[model samples]
Target: MRTLFFRSASPSPSNSPSRSTIPTSSPRHSFSDSLMEENIEMAQTLITKWDNSDVSSYTKLTSLFHDDRREAKEYLKCVRDLQSAMHHFVNSQDSSAEKLIISQNLMQSAMKRLEKEFYQILSENRENLDSETVSSRSSESRASTRSSVSDLESESEDELMVLDADQVSSIPMADLKSIADCMISAGYGKECVKIYKIIRKSIVDEGLYHLGVEKMSLSQVQKMDWNVLETKIKNWVNAVKVAVKTIFYGERLLCDHVFSSSDSIRESCFSEISKEAATTLFGFPELVAKCKKSPEKMFRTLDLYQAVADLWPEIESIFSFESTFAVRSLGVNSLIKLGEAVRGMLEDFESAIQKDQSKTPVPAGGIHPLTRYVMNYITFLTDYTEILADIFADYPLTLQTPLPEAYFGCYDVDESPISVRIAWLVLVLLCKLDGKAELYKDVALSYLFLANNLQYVVAKVRDSNLKYLLGDYWVGKHESKVQQYAGNYERMGWSKVYASLPENPTAEISSDQAKAYFKQFNAAFEEAYKKQSSWVVTDPKLRDELKVLVAKKVVPAYREFYEKHRVGLRRECGVDSLVRYAPENLNNYLSDLLYGASGGGSVSSSFSTTSSSHSRGR
Candidate 1:
């Protein structure tokens, strides 16, 4: 019934007052008739003016009347007075009822006109707000122009100030906050997010936000003032925090209601919300890249990430009402990405250092910087590994299906467990070190470099927490490699001594022949021994092993030949006899051949013999 009454109250042109309905004649020219005529004329005029006016002018006129309640009341009173006059005139005995009805129609038309004007003013106000909102969004400003009609009236002066300050493009924080709060209250959280993105872009465009320093060279970053850089980062972070907080406020209401009774539906809602939140907080990778560009920044960022990770569980607990899987996974993915990035940087650093080291001469008995750097980095990995495990503690550990081929040609799918990837990375560094060792011109030096570095690596691994990750088999394999390097060094140095010994000496071989062969052996041994003994074999155990290796090769062979030839050999030159030295003397010399001798010395220290023919006479 109420709906029908409102529908009937709306006036069409036919139902409205017309001049034809007014009487051609009246009984008296009374005051009521004159007053009614004047009120109707005023109402019609106002309606005509309102119809001719545009939305902006109408809005302004409406504001004026609305602000002054007494004036609005006076307009309403005139319409009522006309209605009362028409009713009294109709009841008079001589009055024309048609004239009274026309006056009543005029009063109704005026009331409808007022209602139409008020409705139009509201429509125009809404349209203007929409236009300004669209314009603000396009300009990428956090300052929104949309407001309630009351807010519009109150903030009009401030709006003028904003327009005057537009030339400066500095939006007041209060204004931004007001706009953001309005958006959040109206459930237009996405618009609130747009405000944040616009502000962020503005900051970036103004060169206030630093991103992706990884592309810059280390020298460039190093040249920057530390204090200035620190301030810049602090400002950037604070701005991000503020923007993120705004977005959070906008999302809080929606997030609270996202839960569903069905598990799958709830999960889907959670996924979407998380995706939105992640999009809002999407600058982590760039921040990580900036840290990667410098070691100091990298460590600092790592510490920051660790702090965040540590705080994550508490954050998750607080937001447990909302599904946290997506957010938790995001943090996990970030840590993994950072871990991989740090690994990559270390690999690159290792390669570069090795290349530099290879181009320089090996320092005598000193550890290479590359070695120290690698070991220290490995220690860092141990800590990082723990952090990763902690962050991913609830994560599924089911192994991913192995690819048909290994990822890098070095890592076998079956052997490459995720926990052991760091170990594999260390193995790669060691392999590179070995390749660098081969760059030495002297074969002995190459072997020595390998032995020293490999031994150091094995020792450090044995002593550090890396042992658990690499395992006993890995340790054993490297230890064997160290032994092999020592053996090779000894073989290459003693091959000349071995070559000097005749492969076969006949039973009838003459003393002169033996003398020539022995002379060759003495010269070869002296040359090799003198050169090699001064060479470094710093490890006591390796040095002793190498000495024993030389003795085993030279002493037995020389002793077998001397014992076989001694019966028929004539002692022509006593001290320089063909079979000059006893087996014990040869053994002693060979013991000190590589690492024990001070420098080049006599070829026969214990080989003196008398030049008497006593053996033949006897």
Candidate 2:
């Protein structure tokens, strides 16, 4: 007797094995038994061949069933022949329980063999497809190498080849998707997670490529035009957008097919991609610093901040948790950097002013130029403070609470609250103004300059919205300071004038002695009046206080002198020359003298000058 075996219907010459020959007629039991044994053995042999074969070859063989008509017909013929052989044995009179069991085992073995072969074909195709992709990429890389050879003639060929190989080995999206599909179809869904890792790595690489950090050093970036840097940053952000979209699409596909129940896996994959995107986006601050060579160019901070702020909505949509966290982190960091930069700028400006202070003298008639510049800078900071407050409005309470302490590095002494750090900066500037005022040669003039500037500062604070930052109490304190300066001016300015007065007279004096005393007093009063008459007092209340202070000091002393010396002074000079000024006239002169000619006011009528003429004999 001979044995029969099954074979693939459309076998390829390279992959298909030679079929065994069927047996001729023999004794009934032996033929049936031998046939059944051959069938079972044939099924096992086919299964073993499939298990041992490479997937590429198996896939090629399996593909023939769909592509080649003859192969499909041959495959169906093999199945039909096996079934017919089994039926033939079962129908026979000699078909006993033992024979039936052998037949049943043969059919089960054949089904198992077919199932195993089917999956093997899919696996083999996946590997072959990946291999082909790699080969094509290698060819492209080689072509690139050849193109670059002339330019890179001095470079090592081995180095160039290594670089090209690395570039080619990076998996493309299309190839990744194909492998993932094969894995999913073969019920090896967990294997598709590898595709997400590849995608996330590619996205990160893409982000770095767009960032171009190695292409330009920070110094080089600093020298770049702001517009050029802005364009580069916009391009980087656009590239990030593309990377985000690509990752989203890839993850969506993977999650739909492979990671449906593996949410942790999905989250892990997206988290990595989100971090890469954030890293790329956050690099913008370095670029902003580079573009901003000075804090005077603080608009760069604003522009960079605005650029990132605009993208936050999109980032949130794409990477909910990861991107929200990144944006908030960037915001906090940007706020800190902005504060430091602004602080540094103000400090530098202060130092520059201080350095120039001794070298530059104050003008005779106006505010110092540095004073004007610093005041203008204060105005800018006033607006900038509002911007900062608005920016951190949504920030954590801890960040918002100690913002001034962090920026100004000052404890909240009750006199200078932390919330009033801007006000403190202004106060510091005013102190600088005070230092400039001390450079004047004249003591009274120094007080006058201080009075002008201090009053200006007080008026600005009280009149403008800056009062809110500096506070009502700060303004009041400065206003009182201005009054103190005015009072100092009065005391210093009139000391010489008061010193010329005669001491209190205990006895009558000669006409000539009285003549000398009245003459010296008149001369000193006239000179003091001439010198101080042109000085300015800007604030009305300060002007009135100064006039009253001088009057109280001068009027009573002059009144006593006139009463004591009038009898002899009239005998020495004629009655008209007895007193150059009456007590009332001196009081009126004191009021009118120090205020500029423009300052107009009325003196009290109650104080009278006692004018005496020489009688025939007293």
Q: Give the winner by lDDT.
A: 2
RMSD of each: 19.8, 20.4
Error of 1 at 389 (Å): 5.2
Error of 2 at 463 (Å): 3.0
Worst 10 residues of 2 by lDDT: 607-616
| Clash statistics: count for each candidate | 0, 4
lDDT of prediction 2: 0.52
lDDT (CA) per prediction: 0.49, 0.52
lDDT of 2 at 330: 61
| TM-score of each model, paired residue for residue | 0.42, 0.44
lDDT of 1 at 584: 89
Q: How does model 1 fare in lDDT? A: 0.49
